[model samples]
Target: MKTKISHADVLDITAPSGGTTSGLAVLIGSLFGIAVTTNVAGDTVAVHTSGVFDHVKEGAGSGQAWAVGDAVYWDNTAKRLTKTTTSNTKVGYATAAALTTDTVGRFRIVPFA
Candidate 1:
């Protein structure tokens, strides 16, 4: 089948302040998406904003242990995933547990409605 519009969840958007790198988590207002490529300030980069993505890189909360299926939120200020509810936006659920010592945690991307 031929169509004028293509289906794509990932999009090319201007990088936010501080720039961004591939595999890093990014937020535009309350929306959460993953960086698909590296980009400096004012540059455009591809970001995957939807679907179930596995092993999405994120920061681990201090001394916080995550269990599989735990609800995860995006800490925009910190640009990481956390179990803490303080000023965070709900992004998705934890696909893998993170230990206290782990600096990064893997998550599944389930875009917020």
Candidate 2:
């Protein structure tokens, strides 16, 4: 079975290079480990290796080479951690905000579910 923990409200995010924190992913009752990024448009993060982004961070470093199927949890933001497996298109409501700068493979949370 799978689940998602969403916050009561959305948090305002701002950054120099659109670096504001976006949606977060975390297991129920567990601590968050990664940040589900969102851009200023207020949407779920789209994973792509287009190489047209500005900044991307994953695991322990920043880069532009994330795997296509990588998953990221939320972190360091001011809101509650929310982890979900509903994927992007299937989710009814929009996610926080995601900039295409983050690498798909690099922006991962944990290995197991």
Candidate 3:
């Protein structure tokens, strides 16, 4: 016997606000994913919801530095990833260290179910 697994997890959702672009972070309800294309408000766009992605760009918290193996959280309010635990949602762990000079940080997608 064999089992099949589904890999098609990306979904199309309407951008709540205008100016959504590729590589930008988006949130729908409690779901978080990266935008795959430019979308205006009310326009349908593709969002990568799952799977391991390389260099999945995200904004770093102001003056916050990240170290390898540190647990990361998504600050929805700021639209950035942060090491702070106050009112932030867990996204994943940092694969590499992030410096204060860096505007964006890379992280592995380990979405909470």
The lDDT of each candidate is: 0.76, 0.30, 0.72
Ranking by lDDT: 1, 3, 2
What tens digits encode model 2's per-residue C-alpha lDDT throughout 1-112?
A: 2575444132222222333243333222232222346444334433221122222333233332333443433332323222233332111111223333433222323323
- Indicate the residue-level lDDT of 27 in model 2: 23
Clash pairs, candidate 1, are: none
**lDDT score, candidate 3, position 69:** 78
Candidate with maximal TM-score: 1
Of 1 and 3, the candidate ahead on lDDT is: 1
Candidate no. 3 TM-score:
0.74
Give a tens-digit lDDT track for model 3, residues 1-113.
26755453677888876547787777766677778998898998888876544343344436677788778777877677777788878777788887866766777767687
TM-score, every prediction: 0.78, 0.19, 0.74
Each candidate: RMSD to true structure? 3.1, 13.3, 3.7
